[model samples]
Target: MTMTIGILTENVGVVGRFLACQLGIEYINTQPLINARPFKVAIAGSSHV
Candidate 1:
């Protein structure tokens, strides 16, 4: 069986990782998802660009 979790927050650094660890699942951070996408301008702008 396979399941996925999605966590949205202003900042998920510690909390997200801890939950993923305790649940024995993978944690996807913002940077990897951002990097996998085509670069574009956000309405609020980005530090990456």
Candidate 2:
């Protein structure tokens, strides 16, 4: 059996890693696609408005 879980957050530094460790899962940092790009776009858009 195979299972997958994904957790999305603005910042996944310490807390995210800790949770993944406790859950016995591998922590993969997909920050650019998951958090960074959108955040940057939002910030840029807000600044422009």
Best candidate according to TM-score = 2
Candidate 1, 1-49: lDDT as tens digits:
1222232222355664564455554555567456222221221123223
**Residue pairs whose backbone atoms clash in candidate 2:** none
Query: Candidate 2 — which residues are off by over 4 angstroms?
Result: 1-11, 30-49
TM-score per model over all chains:
0.34, 0.36
- Candidate 2 weakest lDDT stretch, 10 residues: 1-10
The TM-score that candidate 1 achieves is: 0.34
Using lDDT as the measure, the top candidate is: 2
- What does the lDDT come to for candidate 1? 0.38
User: What clash count goes with each model?
Assistant: 0, 0
What is the clash tally of candidate 2?
Answer: 0
Model 2 gets an lDDT of: 0.46
lDDT of candidates 1 onward, in order: 0.38, 0.46
The local lDDT score (0 to 100) that residue 45 gets in candidate 2 is 48
